[model samples]
Target: MEPRFLLLSDVAAELNVSDSQVYHMVRSGELPAIKIGGRGQWRVERARLEEYIAAKYAETAAWVAKNPLVDREDEA
Candidate 1:
């Protein structure tokens, strides 16, 4: 069965970033995570991670809307 929650390292591995960077993102609230268990380990819900990625795409689209690219040929 697939797991619904991922460990910090698992999230980092999936995102292709260092574990510390993932930790920083979670600390800054850019990503959501929960610290549970007797060791206070962090767990990131898969659904929330998907939401965060979709939000980033929406944000990038909004940015592009405000800064349209111009064709270089028109500058001649």
Candidate 2:
């Protein structure tokens, strides 16, 4: 079975990003995460990570719609 929560490194690996980037996202509140244990290490719920990915997809779609790519051929 899949784990219910993931470490920052695991999340980063899944997203193909750096662990520090994931930490920053959690710190900035751009991504949802929870601190556990006495050391307060961060953990992201699998469902929340999925939600974040879906939200980014929608955000990117909106941005692409607003800023349609210009064909380089048309620039000449």
Candidate 3:
């Protein structure tokens, strides 16, 4: 498969997040990226992005499961 690359604006639109957020992710090494000249570029493999999202979702789910409300009825 051809490697797909997206500009900061396009990535922000697709993620429904601000451009800065994507930039931060790249800066913090949370998201994979490549540097081209003076610009930091992000090139995400579609499968890798999907895996990251899935891992994040699972982490959130695990946290919720571990921190269940004290009052079970109140949770309902």
Candidate 4:
């Protein structure tokens, strides 16, 4: 079966970003994560990560609505 959780590096790879950036997002509470390691390692739930990505897409759509582009320069 596929894993239900992923390491910080795995998440970073999935998002195509640096591991540090993923850490920052988790630290900032933008992305949900859990600290389960005895040495304090972090892990992310696959469902939560998918939710975060979907939220970003929603946010981008909202931004587009707020700042629409004209079909032609002359129409602006």
User: Which candidate has the highest lDDT of all?
Assistant: 2
What's the TM-score of every candidate structure?
A: 0.85, 0.95, 0.67, 0.89
Model 1 lDDT per residue over 1-76, tens place: 7699998898899889999999999999889999999999899999998898899899999999999998999888
Reference-based lDDT, residue 42, model 3: 61
Better of 2 and 3 by lDDT: 2
Scanning candidate 1 in windows of ten residues, the lowest lDDT window is 1-10
Candidate 3: residue 62 Cα off by (Å): 1.0
lDDT of each: 0.92, 0.99, 0.72, 0.95
Clashing pairs in 3: none
Q: Candidate 2: global Cα-lDDT?
A: 0.99
Clash count, predicted structure 4: 0
- Write candidate 4's Cα lDDT for 31-63 as tens digits: 999999689889999999999999999999999
Q: Local error of candidate 2 at 47, Å?
A: 0.2
Output the better candidate (1/2) by TM-score. 2
| Residue-wise C-alpha lDDT for candidate 3, range 3-48, written one tens digit per residue | 4666666667778999899888877977766666555456655555
lDDT of 4: 0.95
- lDDT per residue, candidate 2, 1-76, as tens digits? 9999999999999999999999999999999999999999999999999999999999999999999999999999
